[model samples]
Target: MKSRIHPVSRPVVFRDRAADSAFLARSTVDSAKFTEWEDGNTYPVVDVEISSESHPFYTGRARVLDTAGRVERFERRYGGAVRPLR
Candidate 1:
């Protein structure tokens, strides 16, 4: 273990902008912004673009592309020959 080389980990707030959600956790990150949390204590606020609350994968809101259907439609319209793989 090194002595005093790493930044101090402290309580910080991560705010998910898309989901309007925030959570407190210890982090090595520093911020000039501050916000009062529900605990009635001020914590360094870090704005995040995406988090589990709003992410498509985590929220189950992702749109699955229908590549196979599109390919079949294209084959029907253009009659393009797709060579079978060996």
Candidate 2:
């Protein structure tokens, strides 16, 4: 196989503004800001709006819609028998 050329992967910081969380990972993304990590090393900082820390799915803050209720309402109005399909 031919030699593969890709962007250099370096240690970078991803910060979630809403949850005030940050993590260090290797990425090729560029950033203008830098922050000192626990290891006493500076890495490029990238600000993000959402992350696992603040995401509704990850934090269990998501809203569950009443879709089942809607289905039941439709069935009642249409008078359809509920059947179980194998």
Candidate 3:
């Protein structure tokens, strides 16, 4: 362990705008904004676009990609130039 060489880790609030969720956690990330938490204390507010609350995988709403269709489209456009592997 070293002194005066480590980042300051403190409680910060991560806000997920899409899911409207906010939580407090300790992090070393820096932010210029602040907000009062539920405990009536001010903490740095970090706005995030995606979190567990808003992530498609966590919410079980992930979209399945049609790989076959995409491959077919690519082949249609560039199949003539690409030589078949033997």
Candidate 4:
């Protein structure tokens, strides 16, 4: 390992704006804003729009596509073509 060549890996707080959720983890990413952590040391803080806490998939709020309804509507609007199944 080379000294002074690699970015410092330290505890960082990732804040989710929409959900107002925050979590501390170690990362090498750089940021301008800093905050004092639980250890009484200042670390960079990164603001993000989405995280696992607020993501639809993780939260089980993901929308299921209405394919059946769409197909029916399409067939009703435009006559269904008869094509041989492959």
For residues 1-86, could you state the per-residue lDDT of candidate 3 as single tens digits?
99999999999999999999999999999899999999999999999998999999999999999999999999999988998899
Q: Candidate 1's residue-wise lDDT over 1-86, tens digit each?
A: 89999899999999999999999999999999999999999999999999999999999999999999998898998784666689
What TM-score fits each model? 0.74, 0.78, 0.72, 0.69
In candidate 3, list every pair of residues with a backbone clash: none
Question: Per-residue lDDT of 1-86 in model 2, one digit per residue for the tens?
Answer: 34567778899999999999899999999999999999999999999999999999999999999999998898888765656698
Candidate 3 whole-model C-alpha lDDT, 0 to 1 = 0.97
Over all chains combined, what TM-score does candidate 2 have?
A: 0.78
TM-score of 4: 0.69
**Candidate number with the higher lDDT (3 or 4):** 3
lDDT minimum window of 10 residues, candidate 3: 75-84
- Higher TM-score: candidate 1 or 4? 1
- Cα lDDT for residue 79, candidate 3: 85
Q: What do the candidate models score in CA lDDT, each in turn?
A: 0.95, 0.93, 0.97, 0.89
**Which pairs in model 4 have colliding backbones?**
none
Q: Pick the candidate with the highest lDDT.
A: 3
Model 3 regions lying over 4 Å from their true place: 65-86
Q: Best candidate per TM-score, number?
A: 2
